[model samples]
Target: MHPRSSLTVLAAAAALLTTATTATAATEPVSRAQVAAHFDLDAEQQPENITVDRDGSAYLTFSFARQIARVSPSGRTHVLATLPAPEKANTPNLGKAFVGGIARADDGTLYVTYATGTAELTGVWAVRPGGRPRRIAALPADGLPNGLALDRRTGRIYVTDSVHGVVYRVDARGGRATVWAEGEALRPSTFAGANGLKLHDGAVWVTNLDKGTILRIPVPARGTAKRIQVHATGMPSIDDFAFTGRGDTLLAARDDNEVDLVRPDGTHTAVLTAADGLQTPTSVAVHGHTVYVPSAAYLTNKDPNLLVAHLDR
Candidate 1:
């Protein structure tokens, strides 16, 4: 399928992987062979975001299928939760599920985003193993919620509205939501707005895709945190990212087929690319020293694939 994605691309990418002199020595440049690809998931799955559990299982958002699936350590994938499909075709969300962002709570519960054209199904849904999805919070009609992150310690879920440039905080129990941050800078200039999010090290880290900047907000114990500050800039089309769990290093998946290693100081270098067998890596998740990335390949590549690269050895 998809003609196996051209080996010539991988060969050219290997040549430029290891040239960063100031990068971490322990983090080796990932080559094509070093990255193992798995899960020829159905094109209808349209896998978008990924979150790795402690046991190394990767739970991904299946956008088109209107569901979520889990990839085991051995790479077999099965549906975790399925939502209501669109009733009519040619609607804004394309009559498919907008199951976009995914994040996990400390208690093994999942909070997922569904920005569907259908009003009833468009909200934050909750799921547990062997359970059906229950809408926890209903996103307003004007909201186009996308990326998500959970603050386990505070038992709150943070969601990003790509259309409104607003960050919402919802209680994990009742799903009561309120706009935590609304800023002109957070709004999208192009089609894509705030696209990726993660809660780490006492702060909420977010990437504005259309605006090409990374913003950081102090973690709030309650309503909203003020003084939103821009942490990094000039990163265009960056998607979901993962903390390397190693000294503030970040693996950010750029929609253009590369996973960037970003430092706290806002400097980033490419460690993997399309040549490294990445078609359109949309999200990154780290398990131990290795990083797992999903090639969303929505329209171009027929089979959605997952790639793993050992970032720190």
Candidate 2:
């Protein structure tokens, strides 16, 4: 990737210095944890992505658990839906289902991704409150669908296929899937590529887990890259992210047990960590200055927990 312009670099440094001063003056980068109540999941549930409804209820996907759960703002949780098991049953050693991403439509519908390429387990699933799981779009068995983003205004859903290093577009209402974008930047050097996703600043933003970078492709993109800009580099293997409703972003670095704060210029600052009691904090959701994280714990000492951290108001 090319280096960002010197002008952009300067702006990021200025932002970084200012943030450092503010964080120092504030004592804590993020406030003490606040737990919510809408959880139907137990310590064993391996929650991957979190997408919140308009009413603030969050729908989280359990990656290897074959289930999706809705946790209300009050932290109450219930089984929202489940993905199907692979036809041959557990492939190799992993679970039959590997649900990856979750996104909520403006109308309360939730879209999720199942990456396990088995049984009929590779596709995008849509569900509403009290509704049955519906396969909205069947992806490729050769690809592992890992990230999801919705352009609700246009009724288009963007999905990332980790294994194939490509992005797919499907009708939010249900229909055929098409290759939306693909480039060398998305190809994984090791295990994962094109992992986390979100629509921001009129572009589709994605994270490469193996590459530890975030790339943004302009909206209405087609073919290959007209341009793919590196939004942030040296990310801590970020899983999924939530835009702060402002220009900043909160990135969940699952393996690092930390949430990284990214500024407008794309320089990430360290914010929350294990000292904050984080345990495999896989995804983050934001409402104003408050950030919500699901700590899957993934066999850690603590049972799976929901962690809340408040940034500057």
Candidate 3:
């Protein structure tokens, strides 16, 4: 979650785009209000991706401590399960056993992406409420799974690989995984890292961490595919995004201490900024009118727990 020096050029380009886009609409910035509840975790819990259930409960992934946390609407927090630890002497990044991408199916089964320090040990897992987690399937060496999205219509699970810059599709029952879409420009200079992903309106939307852009690839009925840049500018280290229930607004988490609301008409306004005390805002999800943001710093300091902002729809 540290500031990436390599993203300087991308940040500069996004800033220019933001300035140009903001000039046209020029809507008054909406004031953000802290909600009624917040979950402050212990020093060991570093929450990442979050998903809300139909019952108003939230499930989030803990990266550093390797666990899934279940949070109640009242701000109660409980550790669901700790991921299996990797073997000794594994690669540094591959050795840390943790879950990144988490999504809940309609049946209440939680599908989480488990990653060992090494690429070979990375895979997906399914965990039911109050039960032990079971491995779904192992990912390929190039499949660096980071984000998870479930397509309820076809029962397909979309997983994004940040390292290899590809998205893999697996059946709900954990069948053989195949490449759903890979960026056409594989070179580092062209497309850097593909981190978070969301499936909406027959298209897959992905956030490029290193490139600071959001890509949209249409879900074709068959054959090879290509992705187009739907919103490439106006994002600073865009990590994860969620569509507001209203369908016209998008909440995006900027790696910097801020979150923005992007309208469907291609205009955006800053909703939560550094002034609100957001530290490395990594992931965001909306339920009802309340938007929940998981701050990486909350793993250490219990002060800001989960930042809740009430949206004026």
lDDT value, residue 63 of candidate 3 = 70
lDDT of each: 0.72, 0.70, 0.68
Ranking by TM-score, best first? 1, 2, 3
Question: Best by lDDT, which number?
Answer: 1
Off by over 4 Å in 3: 1-32, 35-43, 89-95, 184-192, 298-304
Per-prediction TM-score? 0.85, 0.83, 0.81
lDDT of 2 by residue, 1-313 (tens): 1245444433432332233212211114466454443232453476778875544456788776778887655456787777666666443224455788888876678889876656365788988867888888888876778899889788989999877888888889888899888898887878778888888878888888888888898865445336678888887567778887656454545557777877668888667776666667778877544566777766464646666556565
- What lDDT tens digits, residue by residue, belong to model 1 across residues 45-71? 667898876655678987777778887
Q: How badly does each model clash, as a count of residue pairs?
A: 2, 12, 5
lDDT of 3 at 127: 88
Against the hidden true structure, what lDDT does model 3 obtain?
0.68
* Deviation in Å, model 3, residue 22 alpha carbon: 28
Which 10-residue window of candidate 3 scores lowest in summed lDDT? 19-28
In model 3, pairs of residues that clash are: 93-117, 94-116, 94-117, 94-118, 95-117
Cα lDDT tens digits for candidate 3, 1-313: 2245325423432332232212111112333434323444464576778897644466888876778888765556788888776664242234456578889987788888876655555788888877888877778644457888989888888888776778888887876778778764321234347778888877888888777667777888975456665665567577888888666468888877668888777577677865565657778887655566776663235443456555566
